[model samples]
Target: MTQQTLQRPSGWIERSRPAVQWTALIGLSLGFGAVLFWLGVPAAMLIGPLLAGIVISGNGGKLRLSRHAFVPVQGIIGCMIARMLPSSTGGELGIHWPVFAAGVLSVIVASGILGWVLVRMRVLPGTTALWGVSPGAATVMTLMAEAFGADAQLVAVMQYLRVLMVAAIASVLAKVVGANPHHAVAAVTWFPAIAWLPFAKTLALAVLGPLLGQRLRIPMGPMLVTLVAGVVLVHHGWLSIELPRWLPAIAYAFVGWRIGLRFTRPLLAHAARALPRIIACSLALIVVCGAIGAVLVAVAGVDPLTAYLATSPGGADSVAIIAASSNVDVRFVMAMQMARFLAVLAIGPATARFLARRATANANAAAAAAASSTDS
Candidate 1:
């Protein structure tokens, strides 16, 4: 009843605000994700939470998922990708190595060119444009963007924008080409049968790998370290990785929240201004990659659908889903996608760095020239 009691209630309300906001955000994300999943959208869980996060941030919500939590989540994602890329694809690669090489190189180059154009046109600043257009898995590229000094928020926008566009286009293409993808991809059971020993081992690797990487202060360390270890373990048959469905969903949600909750009004405005250019660049990359697919059809003697699916610029898992349903050579499609992923992981960093430096130097030069002319 006194002043102190009134102050205590106000403080308690302030303290509880974040909890309440997070609850609403989570509920909204799950609802969004559920709808997208029903529609068979690829990466629906991540995208749903991301959209929900953006909406929350826009509405003046103030809460962030901690970096401590986000880092381990990245490691989990890396482990997921490692397990997803099949080791058995090596045989297909051996047989069609030339075609696969061409397809991979073509897509990477096409994406890089588009990214550079975006930078040149000032559509997006610096290496954000480059990383955004990089043809790796959208989530992986989004996670790695901040480490490489790109705007992770804008990159997330660009990467996921492309993911949705590419997935929608691929679905339409699959349908037009007479591929019935209905029930092609199986729904993941919420609680699948578990191998506890392997699951525990995988979990330990996901948690510890990132800790080690962070301790060593490696850039993008968490995901890279876990990815390397996972590839080694899985390739050598030293370990069989197992993860529950919910763990990844949680990871994706947290990452979504982390990226989403950071948006400012100004940045949102900048994103809006850049949206049309982003769309055009994304479409250009898609069309170029489709042309590469056409090359594969002609030279590799693969079907048009297989060729298109193989050379799809991003969203390897999504492409895999479509491939599973079609009459395409599943092994060949997977091998191509895996090879491109590996190539991106290997070459993407150096490419991004080089392009970033180039972009920086050019901007510096332009500014200097303007100053010199003004002085003269």
Candidate 2:
């Protein structure tokens, strides 16, 4: 009877372990997210939960966010992106295709050069550096990094770090140039009056899109499928994607935690040591992108503010917010941003692979020369 009592208690504790861990994970995510939001950090909702997951994982938390939850979250994020890019933006691009093409190419080439430099310097190991500085959507790049054999954790660090820095510089510059705060888009209410039919349609897309994408075996299939379909549907006025604030918050938190929880102590330590170099690379990229923006101002005959926001090496969503709050041409800013995003998506993977191979070859030749010298 005594033995049975002890065993039963042990079993009970074992069963309760997951529940306890989950509770802690949720609590930490919310707390960190709130603080970051208060601090006006860009992507705070995503970064907060990521930081929380890092803390949990560092302290031996074993629980993870499931793939089932993650794929749909990607769909929601895809929808969020679609909402920002309007059909008018495409028309704007059509008007100034040459200028837009040149600007986008310049930014991408600059990013590639920086990425190659990182590989040559051995800042981050392998082709991870290439993926890190792809100049694409930060979240999408991070999500796709693992599939390409890059270290997703390190890529996340580089991508988000660059994002935070770029957003900060853009915001301060906007304020300095007298951007009108009143022009900012209205904040969405979390529990707004729901249009059930439209909301249901959105839910349906979010669920079915990913499933079909996975079945098709496309790279980052879920997100790509949802992004394409959402854009087409919304652009045509055939669908209205109604995502309340809380819905996206939940999605961001899930993606963040999924990445963050996989971090090990060694990985965290490595990231800490590489922090300074990472910061330098991020700043350098921003400066280079700023140079690109200046070129746009001179050649495209646009205002400095519009040029800067248009060529900013940050997330489109963050840049959009800054552009909207300013007196700049919002359509032009978004158009340029979208054009660059599409360009990156089309060419980023192949370029990253090519540059990575070159970096590796260069490293190998250098190592061989060093060995020959040592033998002599």
Q: Pick by lDDT: which candidate is best? A: 2
Residue 72 in model 1: lDDT: 88
lDDT of 1 by residue, 1-376 (tens): 8888775232332345787878878899999988866766545666677678777766666667777978888788768766765766556568768778888998898888888888888777667888888887566677777886678878877776676577567655665673644533364567888999999999999999999989988556787678678878899998898978778777767666665665644456667877887788778888888999988888778888778778877555455545543456766776677778888888877887688779878988999999999999
C-alpha RMSD between model 2 and the true structure: 6.8
Task: Give the distance in Å from residue 368's predicted Cα in candidate 2 to where it truly belongs.
Answer: 4.4
Error of 2 at 348 (Å): 4.0
Candidate 2 regions with alpha-carbon error over 4 angstroms: 1-16, 36-43, 118-132, 136-188, 216-221, 231-237, 297-376
Q: RMSD to the native, candidate 1?
A: 7.2
lDDT scores of the candidates, listed in order: 0.74, 0.74
Clashing pairs in 1: none
